[model samples]
Target: MQLGKAVRLERIMNRNNGRTIIVPLDHGVTVGPIYGLVDLRETVNQVAEGGANAMLMHKGIPRCSHRRHGRDIGLIIHLSASTSLSPHPNAKTLVGSVTDAIKLGADAVSVHINLGDETESRMLADLGAICSEANEWGMPVLAMMYARGPKIENEYDPDVVAHCARVGVELGADIVKVNYTGDPKSFVRVVEGCCVPVVIAGGPKLENELDLVRMVHDSVQAGGAGLSVGRNIFQHPNPVKIVAALHKVVHEDWDIDAAMELL
Candidate 1:
């Protein structure tokens, strides 16, 4: 890795633990300003104050959420998006460039790609182009790869998840985010298949907070680098406390029971 990229990764990942907790707040473009997203600065502050390593958002969000004074949190600009209303919502297109993220002072840039979508080729091409540009600038790239297509019967199947993660690494992503395969045993294969760090997405909101924390714990046990969860963390009744608990679990190796005490 380039010195510049290494330096930037340090901002979003715990250098001591090689783990991270990134809260994604870029859902407004995909689902329209949903709850937890309307008050950008406050939400960002709350998450950051709770010790989230980074917050991922669309290019324009920093103008609203970037704090002049507060606990610092790394920024990751999401470069691709697709509205939920779109018939082809699974197909993500690049709406921001690596140059745009750099100008906005981002620590990293992320792109979403649905591996089995009809427009998979286009999204892959976009990812390749973005990776090339990001490499030139020494900007880290996180690829959110999912198996969301007609052929994919179970997106959470370990093999499917592993393949998605490997695609991200093969395409040059610094980190790959995929759905957890439901258990440490299955998820371990997902992590081992990818050369780069692998992280799990929160998926839909879970029924209880413990489930969320347990998922993080299990993923980490499976060798996942950490998490890039969105709704579960930010949309929780107490985002700050949950994040702190996650921090303990991911970075401090706290037991799930101990981490849950923060909630």
Candidate 2:
């Protein structure tokens, strides 16, 4: 890896603990301007102050996000997109390139790949090609792998989730973001199968803050590095407090009830 890329990766991965806490704010492309992300800058500020190690956003966001707030939070540029309004939402196309992400001053780059979809083969091909290119550029690639389609029985299926995680690493992702299998024992298989570091996605908004906290705690206990939560943190009444509580679970290893008290 190049000196700059190596330094960036090292900075994102906590040296004291090999895990990471990445707050993803690229939802605008998929779900439009949701409640929590109505003001992207404010949301970014909240997560940054709450001790999130890194924040992932699409190209436009980093360009306008508060530079001071970003000083502490490593920025990752997401390169793929599939909007809710689109007829085929599962088809994630590459909207940006790694070179463009570098020019945007991104510390890393990410792509979303939907497994079991009709377009699965094409997306996987794109992921593989991008991973190879990123390797040459010395840039780290985060793969957001999700199971969704007619063939997929359940997103939480242990076998299916494990295969999704493995595919990301096999395709060359430095870090894999996937959905947690409801149980810790089942989720462990997913983590164990992946060669790269694995993190769980927040999925959708939860009914309550405690539910979200418990999910994060469970994922961590199951051997996930951390979380790439979006709506759960940003949509909460107090994003800063929510992120702080999540930090306790992810970085401090606190239980759900204990972390909820901090909220």
Candidate 3:
């Protein structure tokens, strides 16, 4: 690995455990400035204070959330975007570049790809190009891959999830994020199939906190790197406590019970 990329990866992943707890705050582009995201500084600070490994946001947000003091958090500049109001919301387009991320002082850059979307080929092309450009600068690329299309019956199906992860690996992503396959046994297959580290995505807000932590715990047990959760963490009544709990679960290998204590 390039020293530059390795150094930056350490900022977003626990050096000892090789795991991470990333909070995505880029939803403003898709859904607008929703509840948990209206106050960028506070949200960024709360997650950082809670020991989140990194915070992912759109390219334009660093100015709003950059911290001068307190715990430092890794920044991942999201390069792709699509508005929910769009008829083709799943078709993400590259709205930023690796050079832009470097200018923003991002630790990494990420792109979203919906495998089954009508524009799947275009998104893949964008991901391939971004990976090539990022490699030149020794920047890490995180690919958020999902199986969302008309032919898909269940996105969480183990086979489907594994395919999404493998596509990212084949395309040169350093880290791949996909939906969890419901249980550790099935999820393990997804992890085993991918050479690169696989992280689970928090699809939506869970009604029960236990469900959320258990999912993270199980994924780790199945050899997942960690999680890149958005609404589940940021939308919680207390984002700090939830992020802290997740930090323990991911980096410390805490069981659901012990991690839940933080909440």
Better of 2 and 3 by TM-score: 3
Over the full model, what C-alpha lDDT does candidate 2 score relative to the true structure? 0.85
TM-score, predicted candidate 2 vs. hidden true structure: 0.95
lDDT of 3 by residue, 82-105 (tens): 999999999999999999999999
* Candidate 1 local Cα displacement, residue 49, angstroms: 0.7
Off by over 4 Å in 1: none
Task: Summarize candidate 2's per-residue lDDT along 1-263 as a digit string, tens digits.
Answer: 57866777766767566678888888898888878777777788888878888889888887567556344788889999999999999999999999988898778899999998999999999999999999888899999999999988898888988999999999899999999888788888998898778899888777888777887788889888888888787777887888788888888888888887898
At residue 148, give the lDDT of candidate 2. Answer: 92
**Worst ten-residue run, lDDT, model 2?**
62-71
Task: List candidate 2 segments past 4 Å from native.
Answer: 1-4, 69-71
Per-prediction TM-score, please?
Answer: 0.99, 0.95, 0.99
lDDT leaderboard ranking: 1, 3, 2
Candidate 2: C-alpha RMSD after superposition: 1.5
Among residues 3 or more apart in sequence or in different chains, the pairs in candidate 2 whose N, CA or C atoms overlap within 3 Å are none
The better-scoring model by TM-score among 1 and 2 is: 1
lDDT of 3 at 4: 99
